[model samples]
Target: MRPKMEFDPLAFFTPSLKEDSVFIQDDSLSVKAHVQIAIHQSVTSERVTSWHDDSCDECEEEEDALMPLHILDLPMLRLQPPYPVLVTILKLLSPDEVLNFEPSNRQQNANPDEEAIFREKAISSIHLKNALTWLNNSCPRLNASAKLSLVPHLSLALRANFTNEYNAYMTRIVSNELSWMSEAEKEEVQSLASMRISENCGRMAQPQLKRKIHLANLEKYGREYIYLNEPSMTNDNLGLKTWGSSLILGSRLLRVSTGSPFLKEPVLELGSGTGLVGMCCCLMGMVTTLTDLPQIVPNLQTNLKLNNLENYSCAELDWSAPGSSPVYGKSFSTVVVSDPVYSSQHPHWVVNMISLFLNDDINNNSVLIEVPLRPSFENERQLLWKLMSDQFVEVESEIEDGYDDFGEMKFCYKRFIRKI
Candidate 1:
């Protein structure tokens, strides 16, 4: 018999919070607008500096006024407590009871105190202790940081509770990095950063040369192509690593005969983890842009430069953001994504991103997606294909078996064009 897995408190807490978290991520415009209005009201005619300029007293005062608003806007901020608070709450939790609390439990509860009690107690678990230890050690050594992201919040909490100067410094660095700077400028700020590998997840830190390469042979083109990507942090974001479905998708795209739409048109890839599929498209003579979150952009840029592909470029694209105002403009006739569906909101967000970015040329526009069949993600996976079918008509599709993070798995590859 397969060994039983231990109950994970984080996992138990995640589903309950994910919908609200996604809500916050997608609707952050309201929060930003509120902060801007507050700043204008409070700091009329005050001397200001660029957000990255910390030495200016005026800038520091402006930030002090803004920080509280920023923290208050986070949908699940209250759920995230300082380490001491987390431990105390954990000590009071009954793991079995906490795990069993359903969404309906909230509706049935007449007393608000009961709900608060459950939320506080939910943090206690052996899994959380291990995760906390990892975070405590990893935060200081992290090569990059950003505000409004989880890491900085955790660092700030630690600083407040333990008064650790390093944590305080990390929080500041992340905020600086979030300032308005060109991607090139951002790279300069992180140039001195040295990344450390996570012992548990096999993730390599920045400035580390530990590289893994995956190659795909294109017999039709009489050559082979290579891709390089390093392992990512243990956080669920898989963009830092390359998966087998991506390699398979790359190979399949390369093997397609000449005069295909991909060969002649500009293509944009969403959630371009490791840039494997996009790099392959570039090799096949297509202009391509590979996009992901800001944290993953530096490493993705490194991989593109590693292969000496000039036709391909990297951009920061957050799918949860309003796609109509994408950081990178909408200019591509084709969009591609591989293994992107994961959370409850991912299907809607990913499809919405495609709709916003894809050109309106009906005969020429297309989208190709490769999905690994994982039982855990079955519901969301079905939702993705269903949503795609509603918005676009299927042009062609295929299914195959391959190796994924979970070992051997079956994968579906589908190509679609806009519905009339």
Candidate 2:
């Protein structure tokens, strides 16, 4: 069973992952996470140092105006209690939830009696004490000044929120090294960090069991299920987890299985990360071969077994060397892929891979594709389209609004009929 507690992003001062949190993995065990078919320069910006700066008086004043004016925005700003206790007392809520949230006097609720006000405060005090006791028991080392310096920055994070300062400040505390703690204390903190990444990035990297396959839309309904076990991230291995487009494509297959105009008959799911799309096709009574890189095949097999899909098969077809696979030169009615275009070379590689296995009968062959409309990969998406257009024409295409762990996003789905 999965643990009940993972890392909490907002208040990370306390360690809740475990007695020796599994989230704090040993540094030596890290895997090199490169993926076969998919794809940083560190740059330090020149700062406005006192020696280099020679801006005019007006510019200087404007800069000064941008600086935090109140004590609340600076290091001297005080929390009612000091050090570790302060965070618990303040409730550690987002500033928007805490600051200036109440409306005008006319819109206020009827004034509470002295008893009501006292009761609320008393209850809050009791909760705070209970939380503190838990914290002390869970983390004895936190009794010292370990978190003394965090109060001001947490305040600034709330005040400045999305500004450059806030991002920089947060990054400083959590990035490459936890700057606030000593080296001896880093491994403990890093465990939580690994278990709990801040936002969308963390969501993608964490091990997740996602129930994303649309059972409601399927014919088999509750009889068929997809349970994906995504493992923890290493470096660049994006294929371990099912991408958003896989769910999108799987749903599409289920929707059209009754009288699919686009399917060629037998299907080959290329880059079958987590085997979602191919398994969906097999469940629809289609012959399917799900293939990906050798490193990705084991997990593909796992997901296959998870859904009792052992009858269907998976093979390793390296996009860069498609002929090496057993499925090479074997024809399929449709060659399908979801979110496959990552590296710059992917466009040409994908086109070449399809040519070897996608049936040459132009009148009856097609490629079914669904990819996220990622802004960073706009060029790659366009290039893949252009390359596909040279050999295939779009038979059906639509842009659909969808969401994943990363929040709302747009995905492009298309059925491309092969041209002679």
Candidate 3:
């Protein structure tokens, strides 16, 4: 068997990895370049000790906030056109037209020679009502996206007759309710319209953008993550967003997995929202089941499908009503949960669920938990630790500095074995 390699968390933000450190390909990730970033949680004893960077956590966060984003790697985040796609897009342009590859200009002025093709067609919309249809037909998708982004072309079509095209499209959007557009984009368009009208559309105030779409960008895991943040879904919709506690815990598990004794057979993750920690377990070849409340289960299953883990499992398990689940009586050697303590009742409920599902054994079974130290939840956090200590011996506890979309936070993770 090939020996496991040690990865220093500090080295991740650097420009390059050590050449001497041999890298191997994993099928979980689409490419090796993606291996540098992972977000999830799991941990046990062994080589997982170096996760803390008390003196330098700030520096690391500054360098790799939330996730390490580099300007050259914007394609990975789906922000910029990838080089390969750019090459394909460039083919749509004419040979003599010389569209400078610059991005900031929006469009370049067309030379006299470049206007020859449009001149023959005599660009103009039939009328204001059919402007979008004309634009759709006139502009080929690839050509418009890649080539011929010239002011003269738009000026020719929209200059005299098509000047009303902008207002026409605006009216259609407001009346039709463009659901396809993001909440943020639609809100921006509404703001623009209000400025033009000098008042609200009809109501005293316009609706705000509450829904957010997050792209996890897991090229490292060869997994696709499409998450929706709809706070309006429920009061306890915390499952919608992936938290940093999960990332910190997952990173620790990844770092120590080679010799870690923590990952016992048939791992079960409780409160597995968005299922990042569960995905980490599955990637490690552990038999894993990701569980959450009934409402959150659909997103969990969707994430599983996106990550190419159809063969794995996700189930609905409410901590408050543990026995209501078919899995309530089942036993797992390792049980994990992160950021589960939110409400006052959560401390007792989470501990109760862990005890019920985790196998009763003196030496073999373990429970891993990670939770952020939110200022509001200090009392609950303290109560949770006290309750946990009553039934399990705390093998290791560490505070990790972490960052998520909400920003930087301090998280405490604990490793536990059943008390004899």
Candidate 4:
């Protein structure tokens, strides 16, 4: 029989909140109810940096000389008490409950600095101590699985209050580096950790951010590919334009082709970094093969297993060599590649290799390739199109939109149908 787990709220909450007096005993409710209340309150009462103020003259003013002075856009109020303690209180407090409430008056609009301090104090004086007491006594059931999923929010709450205990907990979690766990478990932990790290360090701190190639949306949802390797593709070496465009085009193709006769078709991805596109294809019920340099295979495999995709395989393929064909066998009806045309010298070889896997009988096969419209690769893109036109007819060509932290941009996708 499985061991009977005791309720140990402190095991998870204490480490995240960094305070011993936060939980309280509760006789009135089940452990799950207490947890739900606590989480819901935390999510709902989260600090809002912006507030609505219709009474302010600035709302109605346009081109008025006093508009800037009348506006009351104060900086966000940082929580005074530890966020964990406050979250606990908000959960227990009734909707009608009021404690030390203070509204931002229009008269104080001109004094931004003074208004900021008042907002902070008002939010802090709400007294989270009682909430913490209830949580402690309730003894919620939180385990590794729950903790992993909650880490991102926990980290954010802890960092806001600058609690060393929570920081220590985060350090321990990352230090464990439990990469061997099942895909769901790994992602539960990784997603939280990645988000926390990204949040704490401003975007500029991560210079290689642009180079982090995500798998195409299709591969992500389809779960077709298992791994992505990019040894030469450092974040700094490549721009977001190339990576974003490739994923957009690849995802669009997969979205439109779902449930077609090609659903279960075997797919191969070249230069598969972070295996995003290929993984999406796998999830769509296709067998996927991801190829890149040997050094990147381990990380790629780790990501595949992290995303719960077990149907994909990975291998190394140096596109410039004539002997590289050993990695693949049997023709594929649909061959897919993204942003592979980096260097001008290799387009011909890459095109020739793509031709090898596509059936010569044009009526039954298709090839899909995505490339960016950069000045350096204009000639290479032309060469690839010319090579494909020799055997296959252009079936579809269009510019697709891609997403980024900033916004979205258009990308190019060209599909070729085999000609008889």
**lDDT of every model, 2 decimals:** 0.52, 0.54, 0.51, 0.44
Where is model 1 poorest over a 10-residue stretch in terms of lDDT? Answer: 17-26
The candidate with the higher lDDT, 3 or 4, is: 3
Candidate 2, residues 119-175, lDDT tens digits: the string is 432324454455456445443332212231222222322322333443343343345
Off by over 4 Å in 4: 1-242, 257-264, 322-326, 405-408
Estimate the TM-score of every prediction: 0.50, 0.54, 0.52, 0.47
For model 3, residues 66-155, the per-residue Cα lDDT tens digits are 111111211111222222232221221112221111111113233324334334223222222232233334423322321232332322
On lDDT, the stronger of 1 and 4 is 1
Local error of candidate 1 at 9, Å?
Answer: 12
> Could you give candidate 1's per-residue lDDT for residues 1-420 as a string of tens digits?
211223231331112111111011111111111111111111111111112333445544434223212222221212333333223222321111111111122223222243354344343345354434543443322211112122221222222223233223333333444244456644433232111111111122222222333344553444344646554344444677676678778878877764686444688988887788888888777888889876777888988887788677778887766442344565678898998877777898889888877888766788889988766678889999899988888878888987532234578999888888
What is the Cα root-mean-square deviation between model 3 and the actual structure? 18.3
Which runs in model 1 stand beyond 4 Å of their true positions?
Answer: 1-216, 219-225, 231-234, 322-328
TM-score of 1: 0.50
Off by over 4 Å in 2: 1-201, 204-212, 219-224
Better of 1 and 2 by TM-score: 2
Instruction: Report the number of backbone clashes for model 1.
Output: 4
Sequence-dependent TM-score of model 3 = 0.52
lDDT of 1 at 30: 15
Greater TM-score among 2 and 4 belongs to 2
Candidate 4 whole-model C-alpha lDDT, 0 to 1: 0.44
For every model in order, what is the number of clashing pairs?
Answer: 4, 1, 6, 36
- Candidate 3 or 2, higher TM-score: 2
Candidate number with greatest TM-score: 2
The whole-model C-alpha lDDT of candidate 2 against the native structure comes to 0.54
